[model samples]
Target: MLIRLKELRLERGYSMTQAARKIFSHPDTYNRYEKGIREIPLDCLITLAKLYDCSLDYLAGVSDQPRKYGR
Candidate 1:
């Protein structure tokens, strides 16, 4: 889960600031979340799931599958 966000962002060629903008977050805040220094909000997680085209379960680390719920 910690790796997923960075992985997805890099795969999409998004810098931290650019990824932050996608979720309406500050770059520092996003970095904190990425580094596990802060707990990410549910809304932000939902936004990231959508942005990465992945499922919350995957981000939550309970699943390895990255597929979204409804394609």
Candidate 2:
């Protein structure tokens, strides 16, 4: 999941700091989320979904489909 987030961020040319700003999270905390060292909350998940145009299911690794559906 963290790897997926990292990949998406990199693909969008966003640095960790930039992503944190977009998500309204602290940069270091966002880094931990991306590293999987800390679990992300549901609210944060939803925010990330909006920011990245991805579904929570995809970020949670609950869906194998290319795009997440039916949260």
Candidate 3:
């Protein structure tokens, strides 16, 4: 999940600050999340999924598919 987050962010050309801004989070918090130093809140996770156009399952490492629908 942590790897997925960083990969997606890099794939989309989003710096940590930009990704944080997308989810209205502090840079430090976002950095912690990306580094697996802190657990991400549910709501924040949901927002990240939306921002990355992925599913919670994917972000949580329950699924390899990023998109829920896979359309």
Q: lDDT of all predictions, in order shown?
A: 0.94, 0.86, 0.95
Report each candidate's C-alpha RMSD, comma-separated, in the order given: 0.9, 2.1, 1.0
Q: Give model 2's TM-score versus the native structure.
A: 0.88
Candidate 3 per-residue lDDT over residues 20-61, each given as its tens digit: 999999999999999999999999999999999999999999
- The stretch of ten residues in a row with the least summed lDDT in candidate 3 is 62-71
Candidate 2: pairs in clash: none
Better of 1 and 2 by lDDT: 1
For residues 1-71, could you state the per-residue lDDT of candidate 2 as single tens digits? 88889988888999999999999999999999998889999899899877888887778787655365654
For model 1, residues 1-71, the per-residue Cα lDDT tens digits are 88988999999999999999999999999999999999999999999999999999999898888997676
TM-score of each prediction: 0.94, 0.88, 0.95
Q: Candidate 2's error at 37, in angstroms?
A: 1.3
RMSD of 2: 2.1
Runs with alpha carbons beyond 4 Å of true place in candidate 3? none
Per-candidate clashes, comma-separated: 0, 0, 0
